[model samples]
Target: MTRVAVVGCGSIGTRHIGNLLSLGVSDIIALDPDSGRRDCIHQQFGVKTCEDEEMVWNYRPDVVLITTPPKLHLELAISAARHGCHFFVEKPLSDRVEGQDELVEICQSRSLITMVGCNMRFHFGPSNVKRLVSEGVIGRPISASLDAGQYMPDWHPDQDYRKRYSAQSRLGGGVILDGIHELDYARWLFGEVAEIFCHGGKLSRLEIDVEDSANILMIFKTGISAMVHIDYIQRFYSRSCKVIGEEGTISWDIHGALKFFTAKTGKWEVVEPPAKYTINDMYVEEMRHFLSCVEQDEATISGVEDASKVTRMALAARKSMLNREKVLL
Candidate 1:
């Protein structure tokens, strides 16, 4: 029986715990500092809940899911690594790059199986886009565009949007860090970025201190360039990507289809996700993959070391926005 401990017990953490139970891995524990959150998970999922961090370590879990805010990620990860526990952290990895190298080093020295939650990579549309690019459906990719935005107030209707981490700077909230899925998948499809120029800031009337919008241009080491736009001001949720290649173009719409147009075919090709596919499916699949990798002591799709690069890119974009200059990686 593999024992699992999920720290945070918030929205994403609760989702993971439910997925774990559905996957039939039931030896689970939920950790949170909030008594209400701990009790809620205990009643909802029937998992053992702990209010103290030490109690989680005492449980001797083989794996710990660090779903806390970005600011708290590195510290919790380090503590988990010291306890000889493998961990899966949520996206962006951290708000800054200061302590990331240390966390990577600790995980490496322990030979622990680690994964970062960039679940967008597991989504059908993005996965197929990566595959089509790799298969050369769009020959010699030249330039690309990626955009994602959603109104912050509409995110969690049950709670106050102002209190959510996505709206707070100190909690690592902002479009750049919050929407890092775009940056991660951009690198996943294209190559490493050599330099980045970003322009945009908290241009909205949203009651937040962080930048609510960002438009970034990245020049990849492959000489390819991409334009990325992210914002929290859109009234409706929107996400899409278009990659133009020398011979063709591939595009993806979150609510639509995966499409491509090639000079060879002189027409458009479309691929749709399976009938029962839902956004939650990606989360479930990612957790399933992580558990399998942990059992086999194998590598994960998005490990800490590789994810650190994405965090670096995000930080660089912020740097560019603040300094009003292109940042070299």
Candidate 2:
């Protein structure tokens, strides 16, 4: 057993708990300030529940997961690292770029295993694209584009979307940060970005102060040009990416199939991959990677240092949107 404690019961946090349990990790503990959320988890998952972050840490858990609001991530992570516990943190680090250096320094000194919650990397569709791009199947990828969006209210029909974390800027809950999936995958496929130009605003709904829509253009250091579009208002849930290369192009629906297109064929060609591959269990896989490192004192598949790059990109995008100009990375 990993003897893990989950430090939030929100949508992503609960999903992590459920996914961990599904992975045969049953010795789980949950911590949440929301009493009803914690009680519900205790009754349903048959796990111990703590009232706050401190008690959960005081128990000396083998592993700690920080799934709380972005503002509190660094504080709780530093606290857990001080107690000699490995951690898994959800994306964006913090709403502001403050305290990250201290957190990163402490984790490095403690040699703790840390993984960011960027599930798109675990998706077979994108993973296949990455492989193809690396294997010269598409030659050298020169440009990429991603279109990802969904209606916020439809995210969880049972809850009020207005009160959710994604609707709050103070929580680092805008589409740019919340929809960081595309940005992470881009960096994973095309390397670091050199600059970013973004346009965003609260145009669609009156329910939230945060930007519900965003259009971001990225210039990669490799001279690769990429464009990303994100929004909270959409007719249907959609995630798609297109990578253009020297000899060909790689494209996919992210939910359906991945295709490779060559100039000779003048159309998209199917790249066969295992149908059994799935991303639904990515959270569990990420958890297992973290716990195994915790047990063996090894490095995790994704480290905090790598995660820092994505956070920097998100923060730079925010600055670009604020300044109404492109910001160099």
Candidate 3:
């Protein structure tokens, strides 16, 4: 059995733990400073729990899931790499770019199988969009727009919104990083971004210290222009994207099937995912893929380098917002 350690028992950490258990990984341990969270993990999953990072690492786990906040990811990943343990880190890489390049180099030099949790890529909606764009179904994709928003308070009704990392600046909480799924999948579809122009701030009356909304425009090296909008003020949760091409347009959202509009067909066509598909299925698939990479010593779809690239893009967007100018990437 592969020994695994989950570094944090937050919401995302719990989700990953559940997936790992479902995938038959028996020897699992959870590490968190919160005794309540640790006890919850132990009681709910019957997994071992540790309050100290060194204690968790001493377990000699083959793999570590760094599901802590964006600010703590780098230190945990470096420690795991030093232990020759494979890593599966959650998204945005970090709140800042400092030390990430070195972190990636260390992981690569160690020949570690590292994966970043950008599970949106595993979703059928974005997966289908990537396929359609690559297959010329949209006929030379030129531009796109993506939007995602939700009420911050509703994120975890049981917890105070202000106390969570998403509402605090030092913890790397903000709409841009919190809803980074939009920026990540946008780049996945369009390719590397060359330049970006952005305008955003705490436009909403949200009581959080971080910005509540942001609008970013990116020009990709592939010559595609994309716009991204994220916010924590939307009363209802919503997410969608629209890709425009020379001959047609493709649009998709969380609750709806893929819809394509073409001048050639003079009508709209719908493409639905498998009937059994669910949102949680994406995380399960992501975990399974990561485990396969760890066992086979293979590379993952979203590796360290990919995470660094997206982190840079997210940081650039924040910079553009501050400088009120376009940033060249």
Report lDDT (Cα) of residue 85, candidate 2: 81
**What does candidate 1's lDDT look like per residue over 132-221, in tens digits?**
999998899999999999999998889999999888998999889989999999999997999999999999999999999999999999
TM-scores, in order shown?
Answer: 0.99, 0.94, 0.98
lDDT of 3 by residue, 89-136 (tens): 998788888989888899989999999888988888888889888888
lDDT of 3: 0.91
lDDT of each: 0.93, 0.83, 0.91
Off by over 4 Å in 1: none
lDDT of 1 at 177: 91
Which whole-number lDDT from 0 to 100 does residue 45 have in model 1? 88
The segments of candidate 3 whose C-alpha lies over 4 angstroms from its true place after superposition are none
Q: How many backbone clashes does candidate 2 have?
A: 0
Which candidate number maximizes lDDT? 1
lDDT winner between candidates 2 and 3: 3
Q: If ranked by lDDT, best first, what sequence of candidates would result?
A: 1, 3, 2
Q: lDDT tens string, model 2, 1-329?
A: 57788898988888888888877778788999889998889887888998966788677788888899887877787788788888888886666677777778888988778877777787777778888888887778788899999999988899998888899877768888888889998889888899999999788954998888889999999899999999999879989999888889888885677899887778878876575765565666666666677778888656778878888898898889888998988
After superposition, which runs of candidate 2 have C-alpha atoms over 4 Å from their true positions? 263-267, 272-279
Better by lDDT, candidate 3 or 1: 1
* Alpha-carbon lDDT of model 2: 0.83
